[model samples]
Target: MEKISSTKNSKVKEWVKLKTNNGRKKFKKFLLEGRHPVETALEQATEYEFLIVQEDFDLGELAEQVDNDKLILVTKEVANHISDTVHDQGIFLIGYINEEDWQFPDDLSGKWLVLDNVQDPGNIGTMVRTADAAGFTGVVFGDGTADFYNPKILRAMQGSQYHLQLKRLNLEKWIRNCKDQGSVIFGSILDENARDYRKIDVPDQFSLIMGNEGNGMSERLIEMTDMNLYIPIKGSAESLNVAVAAGVLMFGLAG
Candidate 1:
């Protein structure tokens, strides 16, 4: 295995650059930290560039899975420099980002969770994990939504990202495509005029839109949805968190 002991190594510097969005865009790759995510990525057969580990860290069976040429042994200092977390896991993987053009499917089916201008990485990741748990086909990141590859989101999602399709798309065009395909589009809002989610029948093929954390759904999006839904708050809370609201609505509608 190629051993990198210096934090100032040319390769180490390039890997550190992946911490930013622009660097990831330029390099066309992102870093995966810790064990579970790296393990999941390997298990899913994700295309990867390298499997880097601290010299003393035990790889056990994992070592056998990685090609000899793709494995790199790094010193603890190098590992710390590459880590995004405070307490480093000492294991990491460099994964190639998918750059394929994603288009709306000709036939829309199954449940899809759409985010409109949702910027919080944690919230977006949580909703995606919840959607995966609810058996939704995928989650769409609309304009203004945080990048899926954001390190924080990648951690929050754990391994659920491998279980479902994820896409970045223009919600307006996507919604219109769903409408043309006869799939019901549901918008979540805080408006009293919207129907209570519990009272609505769940459709097998539908798209659910959860909007910005503070500003609810965009008015134009709300106008485009087949129906708008709101969850009744029996407590003193002003409103439910977007992720929590999405979970309730996704599972409720899934049934």
Candidate 2:
């Protein structure tokens, strides 16, 4: 174990850079704060590179749960400097995120959720978590979606990202590929041509496309889908949040 007391230490500075998106990309690594995500990372067997702890923080529970040789102790100020959250947990994990070269799975027999240009981190994260809870196969992030490793998203996902397949692909290409593979594609768009989602006979395996927060599905994707499905708004509200709509569709289709 090494002691890193100063925020200006070389190692501390390097780790601190991970607080930024570009920094994480540059280093091919990210920081996991608080006890839950770190524990979840260990449990899921994610690449655990190293651990940073506050000098006076209690590590008894974490130590018993996760045994790691690369523990670095730092002062409270250093921990605060590295943590983005207001309530700093004092425990951080330096983990590597190996972006997988995910080809369209050869077996596309399970349900999947596709997100297109969904910019809100909270919405993206919640949708992924919802997909996991609904027992969907995976969630694909299309162009303009929020970063999967964003701290806000990481917190919103509540560690469910580790449980399911997450991939980044040109959604247009992905849709065409899935369509060629005999998979049914459904786009959520509220239009005259669209059918009520409840009326359609849900297929055993399918891909549901949830569009951007402000706009529904992209016109290009809407044209490409097998059918455009819409949920009727009976209330005074104009529309549901993208994540809420996704949950309704996911669980309904899964059932």
Candidate 3:
């Protein structure tokens, strides 16, 4: 295995760049940190360029799985410089981002979670993980939503991203496509005409739109949805967190 001792190493500088969106796009790679996510990526046969570990970090079974050519050992200082967390795990993998153009299918089916300008990395990760648990087929990231490559978002996903389909596209065009395919689109919002979430029958294949944390869904999207839903708040609390609301609706409507 190759060892990199200097924080100023050429490759070390490149790895640090993976932390940002532009860097990821430029390099066509993103950093996967921690044991679970790195292991999960390996198990899923993700295309990766390197399995990075701190000098003293134990690889254990992982040592047997990765080829020596793909392994790189870094000093503590190098690891610290590349880490995005308060407590770095000292293990990471650099995985290639899929650059193939994703074409929307002619026939759309299965339950999908749609994010409309949701910005929080934690919330985005929670919602994606929740969608996986709820057995949703995929997730769509609309304009203004956080990028999937964000380090915090990747960590928040906890490797759930590997199990589900994720896409970024214009919401207006996506909604129109779903409409053309005869799929029901539900928007979560509190409005005079919005129906109670419990009262609506869940469809086998549909898309649920969770909007921005503060602004909610856009007016154009609201008008375009087949039906708008409101989770009636019984208590004195002002509103549900976007991630929490998504979980409730995903499982509630999943049936």
Candidate 4:
């Protein structure tokens, strides 16, 4: 319900700061950008802390649907300072920082996903969305993975983050833990040892690991997996994008 006209205002400065990891950490929130992403966040996120809007942008019906106490009206120029995209989508949301650590269970009894250094935010986000739709229990981000809160990732996910059990993990340690639990870990790779994706006897509850964009899963992580699986491309393309690979595995095998 607070209206901020001054782009240089202290509060506006704080919102601008949310663009960075340190700032996001300190404030415990991130700016949810783009119309669809913001709308998805509004529906799934528990708290509606702030809705920043440009004065001329009509939120007409949307304004009525939101919690009135949490809205903030700002000038278009004022809002552009905090927006990651050049053309503002007329609205963005400030969502609560998720500080919760979804610990890896000792049993590894549930379906899960392990992303190892998949640096592309779009790929990572799409993987998360795929995992959610496929009924996977959670997605674990290994060291060197993209920041899940990165604007591109958030936008691509369309706000799927809130419902998923997410964790940034020490992959080697996490893999070792799962190994003892009868959980089969599949690494996406192109090695001679790699089996056609469908030929692998994927356990009912296991983890699928997607690795870096250029390099597939790390050597050590591949060793940690029960086996390696690859999509047999009839074409000559050397590799698939990590996210696209994940989507194929998720929907093809798991769906």
Pairs with backbone N, CA or C atoms under 3 Å apart (clashes), candidate 1: none
Q: Write down the worst ten-residue block by lDDT for model 3.
A: 99-108
The alpha-carbon lDDT assigned to residue 118 of candidate 3 equals 98
- lDDT against the true structure, per candidate, is 0.90, 0.85, 0.90, 0.80
Worst 10 residues of 1 by lDDT: 99-108
Clashing pairs in model 2, backbone N/Cα/C closer than 3 A:
none
- CA shift at 178, candidate 3, in angstroms? 0.9
lDDT per residue for candidate 2 within 1-255, as digits (tens), equals: 788888899878888788777888899888888888877887887876788888888887678766557888889888998897998988889988776724566677788999989999889989999999999888988877877777788888999988788887789998888888888999998674689888999888799999998987888888899998988888878889999999998888888
lDDT tens per residue, model 3, 19-108: 998899799899989998899999998889999999899999988889899999999888999999988999999999886414565556
Clash pairs, candidate 3, are none
Return the TM-score for each candidate structure. 0.95, 0.93, 0.96, 0.90
Give stretches of model 1 more than 4 Å off.
Answer: none
Residue by residue across 1-255, what tens digits does model 1's lDDT show?
699999888889989999888888899899989988899899999999999999888898898899989999998889989999999988999999887525565457889999999989899999999999999999988988887888889999988888888888899999988988888999999987899998988778999999999998899999999999999888889999899999999989998
Q: What C-alpha RMSD separates each model from the true structure?
A: 1.5, 1.7, 1.4, 2.1
How many collisions per candidate? 0, 0, 0, 0
Q: Give the range where candidate 4 is weakest over 10 consecutive residues by summed lDDT.
A: 98-107
Q: Candidate 1, after superposition: displacement of residue 72 in Å?
A: 1.2
Candidate 3: list runs displaced more than 4 Å.
100-102, 105-107
| TM-score of candidate 1 to 2 decimals | 0.95
